[model samples]
Target: MPQATFQVDQEIYREKISTAIIRHNYPFMFVEHEGIRDLHSFLNPTVKPITRNTAKSDVLKLYKRERDKLKHVIESIPSRICLTSDLWSSIATDGYLALTAHYVDENWILQKKILSFHHMPPPHSGPILVEKRHLSLTDTLFCGGEFFHVRCGAHILNLIVQAGLKVIDEAVNKIRESVKYVRVSEGRKIKFAECIAQLSLSCSKKVCQDVPTRWNYTYLMIDGALMYRRAFDQLQLIDVHFKTCPSDDEWVKVENIAKFLKPFYDITTLFSGFHYPTANLYFHGVWKIQMLIKEEIRNSCDAISSMAKQMKEKFDKYWECYSVVLSFAIILDPRYKLQFVEFCFKKLYPATYVDRVKFIRDKLYMLFEEYMCLSSISTSNQSSVACASGGDNIGDEMDEFDIYESQHYGLTRNKSQLDLFLEEQKFDRKQDLDILTYWKANKLRYLELALMARDILSIPITTVASESAFSIGSQILNKYRSSIVPKNAEALLCTRDWLYEKGNIKFSNEDEEDEELAEDFESIITTLKNSSNDSHSSFS
Candidate 1:
């Protein structure tokens, strides 16, 4: 039997040899042994120095060729799909955004990563949103021939966050500060880690050791912090919670720190109800969030009717209970009583309530204004266009009524105008993406580009896919593996199709072959027995 080499170098070399044989069959016939040397001789008879331009050209050619294959795979996929994307900064501080394409197989099981691509990072808020918009547009353009781009729920979650960054920042900061109080010092952190470890032991899982200042399991972290009331009290009890040499005033705040964590506790409770299947509890939670918003608006509005005032307080108290859920709720439709809802919510259960209520209020006002403007425009457009020449006509009557309504409410503005004061507190909306019109426009070109490139580039549809490739690349690029040429990497990637064909090749012998081997073994056993008997006869 011929020896089979299973090492990476041999496998890579074999691929080079095979490709060369297929490309120049005549040259392969001349070689005594089919190997890398023989293939290299066919490609280049003389020893030629490799140049930077040559290397780049080779990589680009390989990339383009492999990418086209990936594109074919993506186009062949026939089903609804989802797109996943992520952004990471490399050692060079260069932004790398990866997009993944997902779809369901014919069997109705989830199939992922038919395509993927690396994108340039957005440096600032405006550019980030712009980049996000462009990606969406580009994806739609690519899939225009077939398959509407499916919205990745994860990406949608990011979009929702981008839409509400202003309000989110304050809440995020307070959460961060509270987290810092636990992590910044060794004693406090050690104690906190101990408390976490204890709980994790009880649950038989690793404890989260994420930085306190960041949003590490925002809800759960907050929940854990609140749960350890005794630990916090003990820390405060010993005055060891703060830095070793802390000011008197800082120490006092540390004592009452438990009270500051109340909002987080309230939030956790509200979010928990969603995880369960109790319908009544869910409805009650929604009512609670609604009432909180209504009540705050009443207190701020001077001309609140008795009925409105009664409804306002009803919302305020209940809204406090669900303050956490409201914090991250998507502001999809703005015209829906946001003024009263936010007013009551901020008043009742503001996270970092003291400094953030005003800020949250400002964000709500802007969202409300934008929503109302869009709704008004949509409604007006549905009606017949108002003519400039309108004398005693239907359009004229409508105009007269509108002016009269405006006059009746004039002399002073309403609750909407009062909310405008909150607007004086600047909350930048230009930061972060808002896909408010994404669905309506059906823009999915960026996703399609990613999908197409997956087949064309022979890459996956997400950062995860790229990550998988890079992991292979890393193994190949290691010191021990460094001798691997980039050409080999390209060849390995291109020949990945071989992996799919592995199941088709047979490894074990067939039934008849096994029977024949068994017969031969039996004959050998008989011969051994006869030899042993003959030796025994000679000894006798």
Candidate 2:
């Protein structure tokens, strides 16, 4: 009998290897690693080792194939999409632009997809950015790009908090220095642990140093230091060189500042959240944030009051008034509707609330009419192309309003869909309603208005989605990811996101380079060795 030989399907092997690379964000050179090759050979001698070049080619092919499928999906979906664009500059001065789309799918599930991850080579300026985006995506844009240029709400909130943090900088710096000093060496950390033990301090936390540019880290730095207060005080007594320990008075200020910042931190998390519909929540989030800052401005504590005044100044600078898109979003939300808009508008604009509310309501009606007219034109265009029963030429010669009035809504439809929506009793404020689900359930009742809701509700309150893409890009574009060409760079990033879309990618802004823990004090003290266990995991 002839010996039977086993053959490996090289095509399937290469594709699966390419997929693993993208899904796990492994470097392309991962295929060429000696251990990887050895493992593959031992598993099946028939399989051949592939080079990084082959891996790169495989990745590009996969990207192009999958991208076409996603494009088809986007076209078939009935919901109009909302986009977010973000720019990231690498350590090597390379600029990457990530554009993402958010919309409700046919099944009423909210979907977010990456549209482009382009390698932008340039002097990164507003005009250069605008020109590039215009040339590339102009034809595909919805509403003719009228509401496209949305500022990231989370980024603006960061600016406001960053400006506020400046007021308490002196106190923050002192606590920050103390954290840095202790984490410098294992000896210092051991000694610091002794101080905690000596004081019988029950705080199980360790001090965390802040990345000064990220306010969240500053908040964490303050929060953690506050826990180890007595230990830090104890460290000051023996670690004579640790002169940056905050004064008693300064400590009070730090405590108060952290207390004041807690709500801001929570609000940011709420705004930056990706899984839920944020557009409907946008109005309420900002309203609470502004309300908190306004109250703090009149705080009994002089330091807090002073800090809030500066924050308020910055807040007003950016959010003198809200956007029409945001206003439209909340109006579509059942929990708020036009009634809540009326209430909030009065608070936002006491003198001009009536006119402002009317202005927004009129715009909503006009927007619905725009959607109505477009729906008619689309039907007419399709009919003309298909040579349908009527062979209607009305779309070309008829005014758009005429199409809306004659076909969709006429005089008797007074108390328009918008009016009917507003007249209905609003959902109770305490109801736990997901806005997308609410609109999806009611989609048929108000046909044109539901189209508006589908688009408006899917709008992202923050550019955090694109920013998260940058975090993944930061890993892929780094030194250890091998020499990825610009085209391959986009392919790797975009493919990773598409392949792993089920598990949401979260990149925490926390600084882990200053880690001083992940060790048993008893063993590390005896061995005098460095230890680390956190795997740099992200929340799913």
Candidate 3:
């Protein structure tokens, strides 16, 4: 009977372990909550509930186990992996850096895995960041040196939109102040809602204050306020104290600004994807942005044309020379190879069109030659290994004779793999075409070139994946759990991501909803306080 009891207790402990992992529940959940502890006691009063410290240890053990498995998987991959990284600061002002690895697995599926999420000491310089991250300076891992560092495409778009926004700062400020007035007090919100009812306006979204740091918040505030424009106009008349209300001309300016920023907003959303290969899709979007800016420059409105000119200046600063890796990615897309790049560059850079295309072609050919040499070396090594293992004396004799004949006759193929691939017809199916599948299907035919394509296409165009790790980190290190040390924090965040990726658990939607709600409320309160201070200063 004692032995039977011991077996039952062991099963109970195993169940507790499984419960913690499957639910992603906090370590303290088991001991802090009376109901959970009571339930465990009822099952086996002799067995004590694990303490939070013990639970943390269990979590660390689990993380190490999963990390080892992941490391093994990463090591097994033949293609070079591309990485994206970003630095984030927590609520406590502790700096953390997240690094994410992107690669295509053997089955032609794109995989994104977070390699690290650790605290970085102060002074986050570029050299220090790379060194602390333990990434090699001269390897493919660092993209053959830092110049090849692919800045987050979404982040770049944000910078461009923010610069353009300076053109309509006064107009945006007015709209922001108006939204702040309505959102600041319950009484003002009720009054606005009443005005909406009176005006019979079909406003589904409430007035949301913008967070100055996030460009999307500005877009949302503008889009939402525009929906209740009529109600806001009515509120201006009813509430005599509503001094921040935007006038008709200001509203028109806001509408134009929203229209201008819509494309940028869409591009950010497009490039922030995690599951699919984005490098191939980047060239088209970037080219579209360039065209959009050019079109806006020719607009009849002075404000818009001026904004476009400033944006064009900023665009030229960043995209003066498109990164060669991006260009190579586009060239590999069979659908839009060298020809498409040549055409786009000629149109985008009419003055330096010849130089730009020549540079791209030259770089591409150089990369092709490098891949061919690597492939030849790999093939020769494999041949040597096979000959050694099989003890193929006859094959060795044949190889010697063949080499002598080749050297004497100078035999050569008419065209290389790169040439053959370039000569092939571009993929006819443009709609819903899978780039990975295309490469995988033709990998055997253009062996070396396909390997290069697989590596290049696996690279993510944005560091949003790393940014997303910070999002998960925020949830893990919430207010109540602020006491979690960086070590434990890393363990929890990395384990959570690993489990979620493996389909062992799902993150709660409520957590995300709560986070967004908190951000929105914080922005509203902060904006209200700033506006109130400004009003007081003006009156004084």
- The ten-residue window of minimal lDDT in model 3 covers 502-511
Question: After best superposition, candidate 3 residue 357: deviation in angstroms?
Answer: 1.7
lDDT of 3 by residue, 1-540 (tens): 122254346545844664464346455455647888777667666766666666777777777888999899899997878877788888877889987888888788888888888888888766654452344533544224533566667777888878887887887887888887877777786677667766666645656667777787788789888888887799889888988778888888788888988888887777874345458878878888999999999988777888889888888888766777877888888877878888898888889888888887777777777788787887998888887887778788988988987788765444777777777788763667788899999999889889888888887887766677777777777777776788878877787777675411223553454344322323444455587799999999
Ranking by lDDT, best first? 2, 3, 1
Ranked by TM-score from best down, the candidates are 2, 3, 1
Q: Give TM per candidate.
A: 0.33, 0.84, 0.83
Off by over 4 Å in 3: 1-32, 43-47, 130-147, 204-206, 274-277, 382-413, 428-430, 501-540
Number of clashes found in candidate 1: 37
lDDT of 2 by residue, 422-514 (tens): 778889989988877888888888888888888888888888887778777877877765456778878988887877864254753212344
Which model, 2 or 3, shows the larger TM-score?
Answer: 2
True-structure lDDT of candidate 2: 0.78
Question: Residue 70, candidate 3: how far off, in angstroms?
Answer: 0.3
Write down the lDDT that model 3 would get. Answer: 0.75
The whole-model lDDT of each prediction reads 0.37, 0.78, 0.75
Pairs that collide in candidate 2 are: none
Best by TM-score: 2
Cα lDDT of candidate 1 equals: 0.37
